[model samples]
Target: MTLDDILNTHLGRRALLKSSLAGGGAALAGTLFGGWIPNVAWGADATAKYETPVVETASGKLRGVIQQGVHTFRGVPYGASTAGSNRFMAPRKPEPWTGVRDAFQNGPTAPQLGGPPNPLILGHRAPTFESEDCLVLNVFTPGVTGKRPVMLWLHGGGFAGGAGSAHSFDGNYLARSGDVVVVSVNHRLNVFGYLYLGGVGSEKYRDSGNAGMLDIVAALQWTHDNIARFGGDPSNVTVFGQSGGGAKVSTLLGMPSTKGLIHKAIIESGSALKGVSRENANKTAERLLAKLNLQANQVDELQKLPMEKLLAVIDNRGQGTAGGGPFVLAPVVDGHNLPRDPWDPTAPEISADVPVIIGSVNTEGTFFMPPDSPQFAPLYSLDEAGLKTQLTQRYGDQADKLIELYQKEAPGANPSKLFFMATAFPGDAIKQAERKFAQAKAPAYMYLFTWETPVEGGRRHSPHTIELPFVFDNPQEQPDEVGNGPDLQPLADRVSGVWTAFARTGSPNTSLTPKWPAYNTDQRATMIINDDWKVVNDPRHEVRLIIESVKGRAAS
Candidate 1:
């Protein structure tokens, strides 16, 4: 069926049980992060008023609208307010509102300080409404009878900054195109979401270092209870995200409470290498208390302080980089919410037996490197002497193998880009890393977004999040040739088509797209995405093994 054709069909929802989240470098010039929001102009006529009526969920009733071609229900709280006394504690269910709460405009997002104007990332710097009562979710469901498969999206901002409402992430297209219910959420960010509070001695604040993750699981509960009313099948849900969201997805895969809630997952551009250790988490929490000149016993006093005052102290804790910090967070592995070091354990922790799909972009590192940092240029320009020093510092004594392999690949190429390629991209590496360590034994599928965007003067390679628009078929703001002229529609049709197929049957397949294979230790295959997409085994060659040969000896 044509993309919109599927939506008009109003597919029936199969009743079931319950289930389940980066971009670019730039030219050496001006790149405003929020620049691309308006560029994606759509005929999103507000004239379409939705009368979806109030959904009476177990927690409360939510009033939503069916506007602009999709049924949009916004601002539905999944958890209770994370305010004063509840601050830094595992989120509690929100009190049921007396009447139907308005579910119209986007809800208040988690408060997070933003980065500078990053050109490659459009709409990132746009003003996001923040709040303490931000544990809300927005859903877009096409049909309304039984439960359709649901896809929950996690936003990426490195755990420090990112609004769930970024224009690029609007789920309308995915819902309408995939004929599946789509959910996007807002939760606590930065210190509010991830500060380690183990030493606080309060059972309420125990999960502080990983509250963001808890909030995600809580949202899933809301979906399990209410998605059927929106024509979504609660039993077949898939969780996925990019960057921070990808990392969050991986974390959930290793969690216990989150296990049965989701059936499938996809991780885009996320790595499982970095997370706080239990001992280190406690150490960090104690250090914060010490900074307050208070004993660990005085931790309760922090609960009494206003959130605003606490945020100021958190930001000034001498821990941010100059490239305009966003998520000052790192998830906690406190033997509870998370049972062990996600990647060190023997198998996937949370839903190891579930199906999995994960991968990343080709030139993914181009996005994470700072605009004016020492690692700026690349491996190509540095002198032989300088290269040796950097290799030793980053790879330690194994610097020789690292330098030899990398030099053979690029010879005199940009080392910065090469390093990111070998060490970072193929996002599957980190996914596999987590998989290898997890006792979770689910089947896994993978892919790499190899399409290069049409934007000129920008980095030609597929940096980070460029795959988003194509994946969801987000329309281009200005008129060009495709949707509004500037869209990657043909590619979107193929990508989003495959994604919806997966939502429907846990396998992405269609006559128009290539037949994808499930990821396994044997073939170790992946779908190479582009206009001429193809599924290939042994993608990226020995780069995977070459990098793995130098594991733990990398860098922070």
Candidate 2:
């Protein structure tokens, strides 16, 4: 059967279950489905209604629309356009306007080339619009009066691509459910955001390499100054993101400019330990200059060049992953903005007071291995011998030891499963959690999402970005990634509750889940979030041990 045929079959089965369960009440349905059943519908509570909401900001007044009891303001500018001389420079406050500006639709995404969607990863959509004038944010709130908690979401594109306007990131459900404010930001990215020009450029472009990070800082400042009008508590703001967005949160935690503006942080799947060094960033910039055949003094010519011309000089391979090359663009540890790596040797002292929730999914590797890709064909049906050979190519002498340990931990697991688990283990998430625990100033909560998605015949297995729909309480928003099963709403209710609770207080504990203990070196407590949520101490000890063994060998 074709891919569409397989998807339809899965949907048909789910529909049958729903039809059979319709006779029983929600409680009975919950009993049969292995989880709680939510009373609310996936969409709006009542008939969709739209009303204009005007909120004053530091810059000017913004007119937004309210639908289904949630006031949503989109395309709200946080910074000025970075098109001309502003290219590669720190973001500046938008010029004030006299009349109220309409924020009806999403702002432009950072100028990025689009790539074909990967069938393996669910809800894989590219940014709708691209431009240098993309320093805008979207806000969703229950009301524009009470001082509810505020959450700012950073979109993930690996510091290379992505925008806040992606459909999967809709904040209406999340904001209404938690009675909090949700903000999603769009900022400069790729060469426009991270290209380093400090060495060859004038004094004004010294902070060019870290302009994107600075844009996020600007967004935070905007929220701090203006979210109160949207009924959000600026003092109780939490920043959370997945994948590249998570790496941005990690970077923001270390930025001195983000002090006091950020109250809490959540790093999901993407844990960045360090940023590109100044030397490496400068070299990349020099290479780009050479590619353009421009002299040192003529650096201003870059600002005059067309956007297409500048983009063409670089290898704009595509988005899902950072482009493959020695000159991949990313944040720089510039002395001014970012003094050091975010979590290299240890957690940044600047964010010691900030409580954090750090976690990774069970199978992050599946997203990278699309079944149709010829390069990864062996990974889908690898035998024991093939697994050993594949592991040896990457792990060298430790391949046998890894195999023995993984088999001991997960007896009867197939060679493909074993290899994926052993290889895709997020050791960095553990290290980041440990570093936060070591800080001792703030509490750290840990979690592992092990819910295997039933989509694509269960091949994904809780892959990267799978938890996004649940976290946003919009499982119905992306049915492909999260199947349209009877259990989705309840799971989303539980997961979104955890996130909102953390934003409200500095803890993820809620009545929906069990009593989650703080992560420490002793118990290494972690909340295994799924249909049957439970707190587990060191969920994967073997994985940790294997990581330690790898480090030990590397050190020797």
Candidate 3:
């Protein structure tokens, strides 16, 4: 029979077939044809389209798509479905499959309370679906032969909601430009990931509090075992993330299990010096159980709760913080899994030898206070009096001093800009850098992204995730956020070069920018990344000190 007749018969039999040739009949037919069915083919176009790339992974063979010389694999499972009995528990290995599975479509995001993307994160798109079986990852590589550097990206949404499959995080440009293997992971999040059932549940649920992080550990293990097939060097892996993803990278640094798995690390904006304390974790657990009308002895019922019912626990709530503020759902510092805080009093000794690149944007706070939001609209148009009133409420006696210092740092700067800078200056980034430097075994490089975007009429000056498109060399993907100016591509080139350079070696020194120095307590040498890149010693030192002083005074 002809191929058309065969396909027509197959389709007639399987009316539920999807467009991607991902149906079970395709694999069944592969045995006869010696190849999987083409994604786009009929009678004449079948031969050319059937030449898609296939890679053998540890779990099974995955059929991926190749576009412009970049082999891209999406929705590749790293772990089993965390549904039913597996909910709130540590990740388990995925079962071995027989036939070639399609890896062309992106995986589902974790069960999260869905919402529209924040207007400030322009061009940002949420994943189309959410499911418990979200322990998947995507890989992009130039070719599946050479041992190129592998970069594992963790997406940001403060651990509550986000998927690595988001369009903004596509690794095509990064993989092609850097000639590296890029992997973006989709792990559990929100209540499904970090419900803190260790203390309340039975012995089997001991690691439940930090299950989300354990999912990442499983992904790392998968990478170590299977990344080589995707043209990645297992030894030269770099764990990098922005915002909550960055906090995850920080949390992984302290993890005993992550030793030797990660050779390099990068934290952008999100600096998690510590995790949710066990006491707080227990409290959150108690609150959740109380809300569910369940007792500690009946904690097993948590696994049976519907995903949407559990997600409603944090409904209408903002994203949780690394330090367990706002919402209680986050990675916990359970004694068994997390052991201790990642970087509280000191950097984790587990990753003492791992080099790190830590940084934040110039106006990180502007993201949270987008002009379009009604709650934050007033802050954008704040006068000097309003700034003083808000600062006084926060800093008390030290408000005027902070205002003076910020004004001196930026003459003619608006009150709203000053307020955001004062509040959003991530002290944790500096703390992480200093603590890493204190380790003495590995060097820590510091940077401050000062490149402003023309988005929202320049209201968001170097806002959070502004460096993301640049770091991924994907300015065109998020044109609204990064803008399509003449300077965008060049900046993206340099930024992405620095990141890939760090992944290739331990240092970020490349021809893309000038000589960057290691961060120290004295020099505090930080690379000011902008159109005119320059190394600045303690940039805005006085402002940082004054803002820090408020904390000191408040503590005193």
Candidate 4:
């Protein structure tokens, strides 16, 4: 109950003095609480009768700040400044500005590591200033024209820490509750965005192991060339995120310069089935040039050494090991920039005409457990012989048939809530949305969220970023990870109306939830949400066949 007491109990006090007056007034009070103009009252000369708002773009003119009616624009700059020799190369663009620039603030935050002490794993509240000339972005719009429909977002910290100016990703409540145009970005992370250094020296550092996914493909080519002067709809954008920005929308649906620059995508709780295999990204770039002893023709003196000695050799080489070991930073299939393994073996016929949604969160390992472990506060008083001695010491000999199929799918559940709902299943984001609903030609939804944050006493279940302030309708910006509830504004108006009706129309059919369907491979339909939204089908189905028989015994 603190984050300024749930932002002064739901943004009051003249919307916190119009969000401490500036930086686009806290992104226009995080987009006027989404249900448009809920009670627009600002006085004390409403910051001397506001009026800022500029626009333009093909790399110039910005200004921004409208407010109640929504407009925003913080930090802007679509690329350039990955800092000195453009760090690990490949983002470029930006350099065009001339007048009207003052985009109000925010810009600077890709040099991470000021996060994760489990404030619900990365959705942490404070700390937003960092740098390395962080590529910048942030918009929020509701006007500049009428084309509309364009979301973008991406934040999550997995590619190595977040920042699309995270105040819980304030895109002013999904740009005035889906009038659309949101934006967000801030690129490059860990060792300046996945350092690979192909063959060490200079082939102009090839694609330096995907420079932070080509700085989200140069901010989707600057939202396909300046999102229609902020009114949006650069061919109906819609790339969403949650968890490492849903693994950067599953690596931009296997990027080929993101075919037609994204039509739609969602991905929450980060699915990312694979990447980082140019032989473990060139043996983690020759173990970061033998820990910066530097050779292979001194790889341009390893880009002139600083960035805190390449983040102290990626924090003493620990970024590599999720069981395959030795490849540090992420994103790198690199056969000409991520040539394979997006949804793994399929789903990338150049984003088979786009449309996707993916999901997760139902005790996502209680926001990645270990909050000062000693079996983390005795896993909420585990018994039944400490849940059969921690499920026969982690399922050896298939621990009594996986604790009798999760005690018949959660009965009196507790071996730390059946080990955080058997490691929060959405088995690799539903096997990458069941290989894009069995080879897409567009259309692949699926969801699970299952709300459970009654805050601490409920032990933050339904964790891993409890559906980002109910999908940015801003559940009062992390009321200490979503609490002060009036049952979370009708589940943040049915999860921001099924993500702005799947970004205008790729299909998330709103009117509060039901007929979702689409994810096929027979009845695997899903949707679940919570506070009563339905559409189930294979909801649990024996924990998806025991997580596909424990990943076929860990891929044999």
Residues 1-556 of candidate 2: C-alpha lDDT, one tens digit per residue:
3222332454442332232223122111111111223333423322123435578999999876664567878778899988998998899898788887655555666787566676633343544546787888989999989999999999887987777767678688899998889999988888898988887788888889999999999999999999999999999999999999999999999999999999999999989999999898888888888888988898899999988787777764653345435456899988879999999899999999999999988888887777567987678789989999988987787789889988997797788878887777778888898999999999989998988888877766778888998999988767778889889999999999999999999999989999999999889998888899999998767657867887778889
Alpha-carbon TM-score of each model against the true structure: 0.81, 0.88, 0.90, 0.33
181-227, model 4: which lDDT tens digit per residue?
Answer: 89888899777888788765678887888899898889998899988
Ranking by TM-score: 3, 2, 1, 4
Enumerate clash totals for all models, in the order shown.
62, 0, 0, 2
* Shift of residue 522 alpha carbon in model 3, Å: 1.2
- Which portions of model 2 miss their true places by more than 4 Å? 1-49, 120-124, 316-326
Model 3, span 282-332: residue lDDT tens: 998987788779999999888888888987766745644632354577889
Q: Which stretches of candidate 3 lie over 4 Å from their true place?
A: 1-52, 316-326
lDDT of each: 0.67, 0.81, 0.82, 0.75
Identify the leading candidate in terms of lDDT.
3
Count of backbone collisions in candidate 3: 0
Q: Between which residue pairs do clashes occur in model 2?
A: none
Q: Write the per-residue lDDT of candidate 1 for residues 478-551, one digit (tens) a residue.
A: 11112233236777888888877777787776887777877665676678898788888866555556555556
Q: For model 2, where is the 10-residue window of minimal lDDT?
A: 25-34
